[model samples]
Target: MGSHWSAASRARALASATRLWRGSLSQPLLTWALVLLTVVASVAVVTTGNWVPVSVLILIELLGAFLLRLRGMVVLCSVIAAECVGMVVARSEAFNPGEMLVQGVSIVALLAFAFHREQLGLQGAPGGLMLVDLRDRLAAHGRIPRLPAPWRVDSALRAAYAEAFSGDFVVASTAERGTLLEVAVVDVSGKGQAAGVRSLLLSGSFGGLLGAMPPEEFLPAANDYLLAQDWDEGFATAIHVSVDLSTGEYWIVSAGHPPAVQLHAGSGRLDIIDSIGAPALGVVSDLRCVPVTGRLLPGDTLMLYTDGVIEVPGHDVEMGIDRLMGAAERMLSTGRGGAEAVLAAVRASEGDDRALVLVHRDQS
Candidate 1:
C-alpha cells in the first residue's frame, strides 16, 4: 500500500511538471496568455480600485517566470501588472492620461521585443528541454548495455551550472557478442558553454570511435581529431576501457585523465590504475595511449571519474584521491557503494562539473 501511494504521488507530480513544461514551449499561447492576463487584471483592478486580485495575479506571473526561466515575458508582465496594482492600491481613481499612455507604449514595446528576441534566437534555447536532451545523450541509454541480467553497470553525472551542460565526462558504451562491454569517459578541457558545446560536438564522434575501434586506439584517434582542429587553447582528457564479461579481462586506455580505480573482491584492497599516456588530447600529435590491463572478478567494482571529483580548491589532488578511496571502501563494505554514492562521499566544490561510472561484478 505504501509503495502504491508513493507511486501515485510521483505520477501526479510528473504530470504537473509535464504540463508546465509544455506550456512554456507553446510560445504563442504563453505570450498571449500573459498579455491577456496582465491587460485584463490591470484594467479591472484599476477601474474597481481593488488591488488584491491584481497583486495575486502578479505573484502568479512571477512564480511562472521563476519556474520556467521566462525572463523577458516575466519582466514586462510584472512591470505592467505592478503599475496597475499600485495605482489601485494607492486609491487613485483619477486615470492619469500620461501614466496610462506610458504603460500602453511600454506593453507594446515589450511584446515586440519579446517576439524579436525569439525570432533572432537571442532568448537562447529553453534550458529545461535542452537539459533533458543533454541528459539523455550524456547517458547514451540505448547504446549502453545492461546484460547478463542482475549484474549491471550504473552511472551518474552532475553539472554545477544551472543550464546542466558542463565539461565533465562524455560517456559511450557498447557490448559485443553480449559478453564484452566497452565504455569511455572523456573530459573536455574548459567549462561552461564553450566546453559544453565542444563536449557535445565531440561526444557524437567519440561515441562512434569508442564502439568502432579497439580500446588502445581510442585515445590516439581522439587526439588526432583534436589536433586536426588546432584549437588555440582546447584539449580533452579521457579514459577508455573494454571488458570481457565472461573472462573478466579488461583493457583500459587513459589520456591525461585520472585512472580507473578497482576494488579487490577477496582482500577488500583498493588499487588506482593511473593514466600512462601522452599529454591530454590536442596537446601534441601522434599521441600513443598505453593500455592498462586489469581483472574484475565477481563482486569487484571498477570506478571512473572526471577531474572535477578531485582537484578541489585548497586541497591537493592526492588528498581528494585518498578521500574517494576511503569513501568507496566504507560504502562498498556497507553495500551502499553505487556510482552516485561514491560521488556523494567526496563533496564537490562550487562551480565544478562532475561525473562517475561504476561497474560491479555481481557475486555469484
Candidate 2:
C-alpha cells in the first residue's frame, strides 16, 4: 500500500514540474531568463580573456529593444556595465578611445529611441504587431466567398504611396444559399495610413451589415453608422451590388460613388451605370438609398471602382470615366489579365487610393 502511494506522489510531482516549466516560458519570465543569460554571457566573455567583441553585447541589447518592454532598461545597464568590465580587464594598449566613444554614442542613440517609443505608449514591437493584426483583419473582412461556377469575381486595392493600408476596400458575401452575391466597394475620405484606422473600423462594420440584413438596407444602415461617429472628415463614397447568380438579375446602389460599368457581351458594347444616386455616407441624416436594377446575362461583366481610379489633377471626372471605359473595353475584349491589369491600365495617378471589383458571368 505504501509503495502505491509513493508512485502516485511521484506522478503528481512530475506533473507539477512540467506545468512549472511550461509556465516559465511565458513573457516577462522568458524575458527575465534571456536577461539572465545575457548577463552570464557577458561575464564569461569578460573573464575568458575577452575573446568576444564587446560590440556583440551591444548588439544583443539593441535586439532587446524589439523584444523587451520596461525590462529593456535592465539590459542596457547590464551591457554598459559589461563593457566597463571589459575595458578594465583589457591590456592598456587594447583600450581604444575612438571605439569606446562610438559604442557610447550607439548606446545613447538606442536609449533615445526607447524613450520615443515609450512616449507613443507602445511596449517592445507591439505597435508593429498590432498594425499587422489590423491589416490581416481588414483583409479577412474583405475576402470574397466562393461563388458558383457560372460566376467569377475578383478585386484589387492600391493605397496612395504604395502603403500597406489603403483608404479603399472591398467586402463581399454570398447569401440565399449561394444564389446571391453581395459586394460593397468603399473609399474612405483620406488616403493610405491617414485613413487606415477609419477604413479598418468601417470595413468590419460594413462586412457585418452586408448579407446580415436585406440588400437594400445595407447603405442606409451604413450611413447611420457613419453619421453616429460625427467626424469632421468622416464622409465616404460606396457602391453596393447585390446579384442573383442563377438568374443574372442584379441591383446597383451608389452612395456618391463613381458609376459602375457594364459590358454586354452580345452587342460588344459598354454601358456606364449611374442611375442610382444618394449622398455620400455621413454627409446627411435620414438617408434613403434607391438601387438601380439590371441584369447580367451570360458573357456579361460588371465593373465597380472608386474615384481614385479615374480622378486626376486638371481633369473632370467625365474625362476620367471615358478613359476608364476605353481601358475596360480593351481588357474585356482581349480577356487577358484580370482586375489588376484593368487597374494598371486605367489608374490616372498614384496620388490617391484605388480599388476595383469585377464580376463576370462566364459564357455558357
Candidate 3:
C-alpha cells in the first residue's frame, strides 16, 4: 500500500511539472525571448550576405507566431533545417554556416517545446480539461444533497465492476424553506456509462419534480416525465421521501424500488416498509403511488437502498435483507459503524451497482 501510494504521488508530481513547463513556453516573457533570439541570429546571417535564409527564417517565425499550431511548428523546424543545410553546401561568398546553425537549432528547440506543451496538456488532468466543471455538475445532481437539521443523512453510490460511473443510484435532496425536506433516490435499469448518462440527464429534471409539487404528486409527476421519453427497453425505479420538519411526519413513495428499513428508537427493531407505488416508472401510463406515511421520532434511523444491497446470485432478496438488518442492528446499536459498514455487510457482488441512504433523526 505504501509503495503504491508513493508511486502515484511521484506520477502526479511529474505530470504537474510537465504541465507547468509547457505553460511557461507560451507565456509572453519566454515567447518574446525566443523570438528575440531568433531575430538576432537572423540579423547575423543577413550581415554575412545570406539574405535568402534570413528572410525564410523570419517568415517562418512570423507565421509561427500567428498560427501557433503543431503542424506549423513542424513545418517551421523543417524549413530551418533545410535552410541550414543549404547554407553549409553552397559555400557562397555571403554564406555563414555558424549563424545559420544557431538559427536552425533555436527554431527546432522552440518546436520541441511547443510539442511537449501540447502533449502535457492532453495527458495532465484525469478526466480532461473540463473535469472540474463536470465534477461540479455531478456533485450538484448525483451526490447526496443538503438536508434539514435534526436529520443526519449518510449515503453512498458505487459503480459496477470496472466502471467509473455508477448506474444504479441518483440521490437528490432539497428543503423547502425549512418547512419541508425532500429527497429522491433513483436507480436506472442498466449499469455502467449508458445508465449513468441517463441518470445524469434525468437528475436535473427529477430534482425539479421533487420540489416542484406537493409530496403526493412528486412520484406521479416523475412517472409522467419518464413516460414522455419513450425509451425502448428503458425503465427506472425510484424512492421519493418528503418529511415535515416541524412535526416529524414523513411520506415515502416508490416506483418499483426495494423496501426501506426503518429502525425504531424505542424498540431497537428493524422493519422493512414495502413499496406502495405502482410498477417501475415508464412502464405504464397513468401512474399513481400510495404514499407510505410514518412518523420519525428522535433517534430513529431510516435506510433507503437499491436492489443491489439485497441481491445474490443464488439466494433470495429476503435473505440479503435479513443479513443487512442483522449487520445494521449490531453496528448502529453499538455506534461503531454507520451506513458504510451496513453496505459492506450486505454487498453481494461487483456485477451490479449499489447505493445506500441513511437518514438518522438526531435526538434533541
Candidate 4:
C-alpha cells in the first residue's frame, strides 16, 4: 500500500509539471528529458518487480540539477519520493533496502554540485560573465520613432551594442507588417569606448536604411556610415535577415559572424544558417553578405548571436557549432517549447559575453 501510494503521488507531480509547461519551454529540454527518463525508470520499479533502476534514476536526477536551476531539484525529489512510497505499498519484490540507502546518499552528493553551500564552506559563483544590469540606464528607445513606418524600433542601445556609446542607447522596435523590410541582430567586437562607438554608428546607419533601401544594400549603407566616422576604434559582426512572416520564409545574409541556428518546431531538426560574406562591419568597404533562404512553420525559431556564446581559444569553430547543435537536439526531445528556453540552456553553459535574439511567430 505504501509503495503504491508513493507511485501515485510521484505520477501526480510529474503530470503537473508536464501540463504547466505544455505551451512553452519552461526548462532546457535536456533536463526535462532526463527527468522523464528517470521517471520512467522509477515506474519500472513497480512493474519489473525490481527497484534497482530507481538508484540509476536518482543519479540522473542529481546530474540534472546542474543543468537547470530549480526545476531539476524538484523533479529529482519527486522521483525519489514516489519510489519510496511505491516501495512501501507495492512492496515490490525488487526493493533492496541496502541499495536504497546507498542511492539516497549518492543523490545528496549529486545535489551538492548545484549548491553554493556545503557543511564546510560556499562554492564559487558558477556563471562566469561580468554582466552589467543595463536596465535602468540603458532603456530601449520606445518613445523615439525610427523610420520604416511598419516596424517599430527605438534607439535604446545604439551607443554601446552599436559601438559608439557603451550602455548608452537601446533600439526596441517592432513591425506590424515586416513583409519586405529586413531585421537584424548585430554584435560589437568587444569591450571599451571604441566598440561602443562602432555599435552606435552601425545602429544609426541601419536605422536610417531600414525603410528605404533593398535588404542587400543595408549593410553597405551601414559601412558608409562607419567610414564617415573619423575614429577607427572597432569592428562588429552582424546578421541581417529579411523575413516574410506571411509565408514563414526568410533570407539571411551573414557578414563574418557566428552562424545562426534554426529550429523547426514541427520537426525538432535544426539547420545551421551560415554563409561566407564580407568581413566584420567597419573593416571592409565593399563587403558581400551571402544570402541563404529557408521556410519556417509556426513555433519555429532562429537564433543569432556573437562569438561570445561558444568561443574557444583555439579555432575549434566547427566543434563549437556542433556542441550547440547537439544541445538544441537534446532540448527538442524533452518536449520543452520555444526559443527563450534554448537561450537559457546556452547561457547556463556559456563563459563569455553571451547575447541572443530569436525570431518566432505567434501561433494564434
Candidate 5:
C-alpha cells in the first residue's frame, strides 16, 4: 500500500508540472524566452558587424508589446533600449541618424499603445477578443427559442449611428415545459454606444430574471437592480410580455414604454394596448406595474417596439404610432420577413436606437 501511494503521488506531480509548462508557453514565460533570444541576437549583430539590421530587433520589440503583460513589456522595452545603446557604441559608422529617429518614434508609439491598453485593464488582441465574446453573448440572450407549430416570432434591433452596440435590447425565455413564453424589450436612456455599457449590464441581469421566477416578479426585481446602480442617467423603459403558447393568452406589463399594437385579423384593423402603465424603471421606489391581459387567435399578430420608431421631432407620439401602424400593415400584408420588413419600411427617428418584435399565430 505504501509503494502504491508513492507511485500515485509521483504521477500526480508529473501531471501538474506538465499543465504548468503548457500554460506558461502562451504568456510571460514565452515572452521572457523571446527577450533572451532577442538579447543574444543583438549581441551577435554587434559582434558580427551589421550582418542583421537593428530594425529587425525593433520589430521584435513591437511584437513583444502585443504579446507581453505590463511587466514583460517593460522588460522587453528595457532590453531594446540597451541594445540600441550598444549598437550606437559598437557600430556607430553603420547607424544612420535618420534610422535612429524613426526607431525612436516607433518605440514611443509602442509604449503609448501599451499604456493605453493597461489603462483599460486589458492589453493586446485579448481585450478585443473579450469584447467580441461579450457582444455575441448579448446577442444570444435575445434569440427567441423555438415555439409551438402555430406560433411564429421574430425580432430586430438597430443601433443609432450604425454603431456596433445599441441602447435597445431584448431578453426572452420559455418556461412551464415550453408552454409559457416570456419576452422583455428594454431601452436604456441614451443612444448607441453612449448607453451600450449599461445595456449590456441590464441585458444579462434581465435575461437571468426572465424565466428564473414568476413572470410578475421580474420587473420589480429589475427596477430594484437599476435603482441600486445610482447612475446619473440610469432610468430606462421596458415592456414585458408573457404568453401561454398552448392557449394564446398573454399578459403585458409596461414600465413607461410605448404601447403595444395588436392586429385583429378578422376585422383587419389595428388596436393599441394602452392600459398597462408604470413609471420608468430606476426613477421610482415601491413601483407597482398593473398588467393588461389578452388572447391571440389564429391569424393574429402582436407588435412591440421602442419609442424611436415613433418619436419624430415635430410630430406628437400619436402621429408616430399611426404612421407605424400603416407601415406595419403594409409590411405584414406581404407575409415575408415581417419584423425586418417593417423596420425597413417604417421611417424612424434617425438619431435614436430602434428595435421591434413581432409575434404571430398562424391560421390552422
Candidate 6:
C-alpha cells in the first residue's frame, strides 16, 4: 500500500511538473519545483485536514517563485507535488476545498507578481534549493565521457551546490569537416545569474564567432562582450581557441587563462604558445594584444587547459605555466596519453580540480 501510494503520488507530481514545465518550459526546473509544491499542498490537505502539512511546502514554493528561474521553479514544483500528493491520497476524506482555496490564494497574493524572481524574498534553504535544481539541470547536460573521444563537450558546475551553478563550462563541438570546430570553454568567478549571465554571454557571443570567423577574429569578439558586460574586476579568466586539424593551425586569445601547447610532429618536442594575451577580457579597455597562433603538424598535438589544471599549490608556489609545460613534454615523450597525457600528470601532481582538453592533429 505504501509503495503504491508513493508511486501514485510521484506520478501526480510528475504530471504537475510536466504541465508547468511545458508551459513555462523556458525554466523547466523552476516549473517542476512549483508543480511539486502544488502536489505537496494538495496532499497535505488530504493527509491532516489541517494547514500544518503544507506550511513548510508553501514556504518552499514561495521561495522558488522568488529565487529560482521559471524552469527551476517548475521542476521544484513537481517534487513538492509528488510529496504532497502522496500524503493527500493516503487520506482521501476530510478534504475541504474552501479552506485549501483560501490558503492557496493567500500564498499567491503574498507572491505579489508571480513572475519576478528578484522581487522574491527567497533566502537560505529556499535560495539554495533553487540553485540545486538548476545545477542538476546543467549536470544533466554535462555528459562528459569518462575518457576523451574524437568529439566531446561539457558545461559542468564546480560544485553541486544549487547556489553554485556558474563556475566554468566547457564544450567541444565537432565540425562538419570531421575536425572539432573549436573547444569552447568559459570560467566565471561567482554563481547566480550575475555569473551565469556572463558565462552565457561569453559562450554565445564567442561560440557564435567561432562558427564563422577565424581564431584571430574570435578573441576580439569575446573581449568586446567582456568589456561590454557589467562585471567588476576579478570575475574573468578564460582561454577560447580553435585547433585546425587540416592545416595544423591553432588560434587562441586569452584573458588570464592557461596557455595551450603545440608539439613537434616527429621529435616529440612541445612548445608553449607565444603571444601577449589580452588581460582577462573585461579588465582592460581595448586590448592591444594579438591572438596567439601556432602550428600542430600532422602527428603533432595541442593541449588546452583551464587554471584549475595548474592552480594546485606545491610547496608554496602555485604550479603555473612553466610546470605545466614541463609536465606536458614529459608526458608526450613517455608516450603516455600524448596530447591528453598532461591531464593525468596534473592529477597525480595533485588532484586540484583539473580540467584538461587535448587536441591531437592526426588524420581521421
- Candidates' lDDT values, in order? 0.70, 0.81, 0.71, 0.56, 0.84, 0.55
Worst 10 residues of 6 by lDDT: 151-160
Task: Write one digit per residue (lDDT tens) for candidate 5, span 1-364.
Answer: 5443343454455456545545654676767887887888788777777587777877787787767666677778777777788889888997889877877887778877888888876655455545655566667779899998899888989899788788999999999999999999999999988898899999999999999999899999999999999999999999999999999999999999999999888887889998457999999988799999999888889999999888999889999999999998887855755887898888686689999999898898
lDDT, residue 349, model 5 = 69
lDDT (10s digit) by residue, model 6, range 118-195? 345332234434444444444333333332333223222342133444555665444546553566555667544456
Per-model TM-score versus the true fold = 0.71, 0.79, 0.65, 0.50, 0.77, 0.54
Q: State the lDDT of candidate 2 residue by residue for 1-364, as single tens digits.
A: 5443343454455456445534553546656666676676666655665476556657766776665655555565565666555665664455567667766777677777777777765556545544556677777788889988789998888899899899999999999999999999999999999899899999999999999999989999999999999888999999999999989999999899998999899998999987458999999887778789999999999999999999989999899999988888888768977789888988569889999989999998
Candidate 5 TM-score, true structure as reference: 0.77
Clashing pairs in 3: none
Model 4, 219-294: lDDT tens digits are: 7776666656745555666677776656778787776778878877777788887654678777877877778898
Off by over 4 Å in 4: 1-181, 192-194, 330-340, 347-351, 362-364
Write one digit per residue (lDDT tens) for candidate 1, span 137-213.
64452245656743577776777664467777555566676777887887788876567767777887787777677
Model 6 Cα displacement at 224 (Å)?
2.1
**Among these predicted structures, which one has the highest TM-score?**
2
For candidate 1, give the lDDT: 0.70
What lDDT score goes with residue 321 in model 3? 87
lDDT of 3: 0.71
Higher lDDT: candidate 2 or 5? Answer: 5
Better of 5 and 6 by TM-score: 5
Top lDDT model: 5
Ranking by TM-score: 2, 5, 1, 3, 6, 4
Query: Candidate 6 has what TM-score?
Result: 0.54
Error of 1 at 318 (Å): 1.2
